[model samples]
Target: MSMSGEDDGPADSGLAPEGVTNDLVELLFFAYRDFVGDPDRMLAEYGFGRAHHRVLHFVYHYPGLTIAELLDILRITKQSLNRVLKDLIEQGHIVQKTGRSDRRQRLLYCSETGATLTAELTRVQVRRVARAIADPVADEPKGARDEHGFAAAQGFLMAMIEPEERAAVRSLMARRARSRR
Candidate 1:
């Protein structure tokens, strides 16, 4: 059957609503694929996968993050987390220590090697992002246009997030930044 909107009535069409461009949906998919491509290849060399990359990224950023906090942030089951955590710890990419205040709690941190790998992966992605943003079509010469473009891009991405989760997302980012200082 032809899926074209021209052949189907509005109610029968599977297209997005007015003002929503289907091109944006496809662009996001392709953008994300390329964005993760470099890291995915590197992780394979270590016999790891995306899960390992995520764990390393989070622990590297949020040093001393509790097992519970990681669990919550990842939204994964304890059992699922245990497998990846065990592999990371065994490979010396991560270390777990007992919390000073709560002896039963395990706090996560990246080892020196983990930090190096994470930084390398992040550098690759950051370079790609910098190039994209610095492109003439994406960003204008220093001025109000540049600032406005940044704001518009930021606003667009933020709006893509679920409304209820936006505050929590912002809080986590701010907290991580403050912790680094």
Candidate 2:
């Protein structure tokens, strides 16, 4: 059970006996904080918060997302989501339409202003991620690490999610992509 040996077991391989990797846990925490920080500040300027940002981001990306679908995606209580939804609707940042077949369903869509603001907020985040992925290649050849970095990052992020949820997430992404076209 030598910690310094190349043949270290799971207990000595930088993970706790419970199989938790402290370094990864901390990295995820820090990464999420910074990733959402940019949008949080931007949302504050509009008298909104992270909740509003999340709603706007999702609705903007997935127009026509139903209230139930949004609730599922955000995993927030109805009351909590209602407050944010009310503000966004009253402020004219979002529009909710009754579903054609399901009259009880409220489909969400971002207004022009909302889209503009969401884009601006998202641009900062996209830039931050782009820099992060490209940083590894700063001293390397142009194409040497770009694809590898992107694929690795994507794969790592996907792997972090629960196995059962991965297919649903991918399906949602694919549906959104198809709708964008």
**Each model's lDDT:** 0.71, 0.72
lDDT of 1: 0.71
RMSD in angstroms, all models? 14.6, 14.1
Can you tell me which runs of candidate 2 are displaced by over 4 Å?
Answer: 1-8, 11-20, 137-181
- Give per-model TM-scores: 0.66, 0.66
lDDT of 1 by residue, 116-178 (tens): 999998888777676555542321134463322343454444444434554665565556557
Top lDDT hit: 2
Relative to the unseen true structure, what is the C-alpha lDDT of residue 80 in candidate 2, on a scale of 0 to 100? 98
Worst ten in a row by lDDT for model 2: 15-24
- List candidate 1 segments past 4 Å from native: 1-20, 136-181
User: Which TM-score value belongs to model 1?
Assistant: 0.66
lDDT of model 1 at residue 100? 96
